[model samples]
Target chain A: MAASALSPIRIDDPADPRIAGFVSIKERDLTGRQGRFIAEGTVVLRMLAAAHHAGRGLAAEAILLLESRVAGVEAIVREFPAEVPVYVAAAPVFDAIAGFNMHRGVLALGRRDGVSGRDALIASLPASSLVLAACGISNHDNMGSLFRNAAAFGVDAVLMDETSCDPMYRKAIRVSVGSVLTVPFAREGSAASLIERLQHEGFAIWGLSPAGETDIGGIPPAARTALLVGTEGEGLPPAILESVRTARIRQRPGLDSLNVSMAAGIALHQVALINDRI
Target chain B: MAASALSPIRIDDPADPRIAGFVSIKERDLTGRQGRFIAEGTVVLRMLAAAHHAGRGLAAEAILLLESRVAGVEAIVREFPAEVPVYVAAAPVFDAIAGFNMHRGVLALGRRDGVSGRDALIASLPASSLVLAACGISNHDNMGSLFRNAAAFGVDAVLMDETSCDPMYRKAIRVSVGSVLTVPFAREGSAASLIERLQHEGFAIWGLSPAGETDIGGIPPAARTALLVGTEGEGLPPAILESVRTARIRQRPGLDSLNVSMAAGIALHQVALINDRI
Candidate 1:
């Protein structure tokens, strides 16, 4: 099979040992130890290739291509750096290992990077900048969307607190549309500690909570502002809420809150208003 | 088999005539035409029951319960109106018909309703109110979340344009967490026509565009505002943009835009500020 003329090694059997990387995708327990994340669809593969070329240091360990999709896969591979490997297999074998019908017939396994710490991220940003601090958001899709929003809204940095999920999770990466790679992010300490530290650095910490007495419009356009958003179910912890200046996006009377990610987007946009004036 | 103690309708074959409703789910061509949508998991089933009870005139056509979920199903059924049908099936048969593993062990088929029209909705809300007019959003999940935001922010109504996906789609229903039932929404005509009609009704149509010249905060808090949000990609059409007053959520420099749904949430929240002052 290794000596086959095709660039992708063909595996006729679903149970083949060579397809172990694809097989473990459905088995969540193995994901952590394997340290490999899958990227689906052509757009993501292109992103990986771009990231690889830039030496952002993220690269695919291997590529899985369905026989039917080999041509498109070949086009993508042509753009890949010389060191990358591509593997091909029958559709049934690919589907069996993927645990779902493969859309766009391409998947890549890339090694995950350890999250940077708060100081590293702070050092990376300019003196006066806008940052998004995500706290207690466990859902990967929401995390990804938040990152995408952060990038779209020109948030200078994203800081994840203790309770958030891994931004590098496969679902998060996909949902982020690979914006997670382009944006600078780090997992800081707990929300309270981070808020306190940010405040000490002359950053105004505005906690987004419906419980806030101050309207979001009242939040002065600051040179440095960090918008803090909490989890959906339980909002910002009381300690964290108290440690920061609290502001609420005014909502209708019966409605108490917005989805955390959506709330973050709204807040980030509002905070970015000062920058638009320039 | 239909008269058995367990109400078990034994079906040895996938082509069995009695299982037509379940079979139609897997056939893409038959799905929308069949006048039914599948609602899986207990939370969704419970939501269906709530919708049924709210006298909104929506009801589940039937409930399918697998052996393992029978007790939970029975609990839900007990609260359901007497007219709703409940069916119990062996695990394998239920799985076969649904074309997926039934983890929640329960599924409900609900009759589809044609989305309401704009005039009917305007007649329902107070003369002066806040409304969210979703112009061209296509993503079902985003549509659902927008409905949820509308409900949470206490927007008096939601008006979808012709290009928006049906809010009653299964994914939309689930993503809204059933708020679609609580939020009154209707499909309006094209964006330009809707804006014109809304303006005649004394509603201030605030077009939510990232590139708009005015800040969202600058909009007078006392006016009856209709926040218009567009699709993620193309944004609100030019005709629509020219037809109404425009305001943008202020964001930092270099950032492009917020997600449509999130922008809706923020705009809704900001609109609600007038209500708070009153």
Candidate 2:
């Protein structure tokens, strides 16, 4: 399953600048690259390859695999274009380069082509589309889980505020199970701007909060719907909640709100128009 | 809010035997206590205190709080009966005791009163109740997230497989946001046995797998239903999937499957009789 036009490169030096993107992964996680992200594990690597092949602006600049793991992922690695280099490192060198155990044995550096274009993406949604928008979702795992839910319900796109965490964060991508690689997302503008823009596009924006006025289950379906999710503890802000229709998942009282990702999934499933999706 | 009957004792040494349960917190996370578990944060502490007051097995043995955070959580501490000791530690001492930076600044040693009784809990379920059964869920966070969803949807109880991770795992409890404290669970039998028992109890046993033969949304609501969620990759095993009524959350074809917790939430929202719950 090896690619004929390109052969795997051997990475031996821990200080090699060619592998700079993969070094100190924990620290790099805190400070992301210009427009690049790391996709770890076999599943996420495959997703990166798929996104690269789809010509969707995501490109695999290079791939680093454990010497022992190459055979297992040969088919997936072969799917990448010949120009993308696959680097194989001995287990010890790989771990040293990554600054951790790096047990998953697979890592790929992926770069998104361009800058944020929230308004353009908002303006481009077709009529009768389902979208998920988030405000102040600063947690990486939460953002990743949200993307996974959005993808499962066939959300057309995920829109987040400037304050939201990057969907490309490594932990977020891992938690998403590579859904971050598959789903399209835009992170720009304020939460209010996203709501106003969706409303302008004739999309019904529903803010999901525990104190919402309407039950999410019975909310009437609309042609184009946007499910708005917020951070776990402090849900959609008051002005944002009041700016759009607010709906709460029907749940037992006395406890705090549902975890944000669970709430997103429930809300998405309700308004997702399943027949059109699956 | 200074629990008049009990006073907070100042703790200066991390090596004190009185707080043995709280030391080596990380290692203790892997190897659990005989019947004790640590509950962190103000929210979980409140739940543990509530469970203690209700005399439902869970009792707060002792508490450790950062000196700075003691005042903010005094109301919750006072809720605990006078018998439970409250310990205050300087910030440095508390962090040293936890083996990490303990930012939330609250930890309580909670003890379950007795051993596992899976059959007893199943027997006690109301004629019309929603339940969640987990099979092969080894990941602590997933178990924790499942419990959180169960609590949010008002599930009567969570019955897990013998192989599933313990809900009382420190990370699991924290991820569950103390739902593990409030929600009752039993992990005593094989997944097949759990399913079989639920079926015998006149409950609708639905195995949630991506390969499920039935669509989750259109399934008619039942007086009682049990939603089964398996591990992330290899979902409900073949025999178990075949043994119960199989239902799939409709999703786009290209993706593999939804995160188990998200799937559980979506499925529970559809099958749960929300109006009757709250």
Candidate 3:
């Protein structure tokens, strides 16, 4: 529990160049990032530290905390690698640097392994695994909730296509309660290739739809099952539905469908229960 | 589908006083209201329209639609009562009136059956019913998703404690895809009284938790069941958990719990399936 890994740096000026990566987070989230993303709140920061501690393809470069929060979170902060810098600033200075009021008072800068990092990570999962895949999930909250569900159900990894929102988006990471850091995820390629690669990996691909021939409840347990979900409005693309085995959640008729994240949660829970992984 | 019930009204000025209720919507949501809330997006507007048509205690007093969207939604417009006015405005004008960019171009001034309306509605549900009880669900998204799941699982009603967020909140209604209008809900009294009243009415209350003894999969079907969910993080208050028969949606150890909405979906689906209602 010793905090040997971090020497708290005092930042008095919000304009200090050292903390520029966190400036104007909302705008930066819209435009792509330069391989860096913000992880907000204490939970997410801990996840980043844990991932870094485990060498699970994500590392924390720095942490910024409101001066008052430092005392409360010091024990957790000490767990990060010694090389990772920790900075503390007054509330005003921290708000100035962040370009908004950050009530959580804890933020971390996370760096993924590389562009192809998630793909390589996915290729390394064990034979018995559960994965939650996102095809066109662009909403940050949906992206985070999906990961949180995946983690709760013990899914091995989360695979996302280019159309999906970044799992590291600050809002997403916060919404996931830092599950984005705990759950492994990769965002690469088109939906077609993502599906093809999973099938080639000896995984059974089950795309969730409202009109599947068989309900998700009856999808007999399997060793490696990849549950595919699409964006909210239009569900999984026609190509993916036709190419993979599609299963419906059996929601009552009349309503369109459940929210994408909720659907994933239900489907993942069923899969985990069926496989006795829970 | 004839729209003889609704007559189109043309609006050229953004500050036509007729649309003041929608101005500065974000702030208005926090302050008080005159039994009115803004319903945005086509899906929610349609729900409002349906509620009005069915005399379900909700009515559309007026509609502010972008002139361009009028033709596309003509079929839906005709479903409303002829007294409900449909106001068409230029996008710029609508944005000015709303004090923000109204991208969806469909906004309706909805008049609910007042605070006591939903309470009376909830009291009127049948002897055999499936209801969703929200104790401390304060998040708008979670509230909306709960309503959406209730609709999907054929839950008869969504009853919220006074601490819960307003289901009529614009974002919640949109997230629920207008299910907030279709499904009956009442946010009144304390969680204790709400549960007591449901118990008095024959509801077998099942509080969802991560530490419960009975697994959600094992919850046998009943004539009347009320699934209770609390806010994220704090979960259901200890008082409620101890008083009711709690059940857990089994998940892997170490993880805290599933998202509130996700848990509701899984539990509702399980209960619905057990009852042979789905």
For lDDT, the strongest prediction is: 2
C-alpha local distance difference test of each model: 0.73, 0.84, 0.83
**Per-residue lDDT of B138 in model 2:** 87
Model 3: DockQ against the native?
Answer: 0.80
Model 1 Cα displacement at A245 (Å)? Answer: 4.7
lDDT of 3 by residue, B198-264 (tens): 8888889999988776898888788899999998778998889998999998876776577788888
Docking class of 3: medium
Interface RMSD of structure candidate 3 (Å): 1.0
TM-score winner between 2 and 3, please give it.
2
Q: How many clashing pairs does model 1 include?
A: 7
TM-score: which candidate is best?
2
How much of the real interface does each model capture, measured as fnat? 0.63, 0.80, 0.83
Q: What is every candidate's C-alpha DockQ against the true complex, given to 2 decimals?
A: 0.38, 0.75, 0.80
Higher-ranked by lDDT: 1 or 2: 2
Off by over 4 Å in 1: A1-30, A33-116, A188-204, A220-224, A237-245, A253-256, A274-278, B1-30, B33-56, B59-116, B188-196, B199-202, B219-224, B238-247, B250-257, B274-278
Candidate 3, residue B35: Cα displacement in angstroms equals 1.3
Clashes of each: 7, 0, 3
Worst 10 residues of 1 chain A by lDDT: A26-35
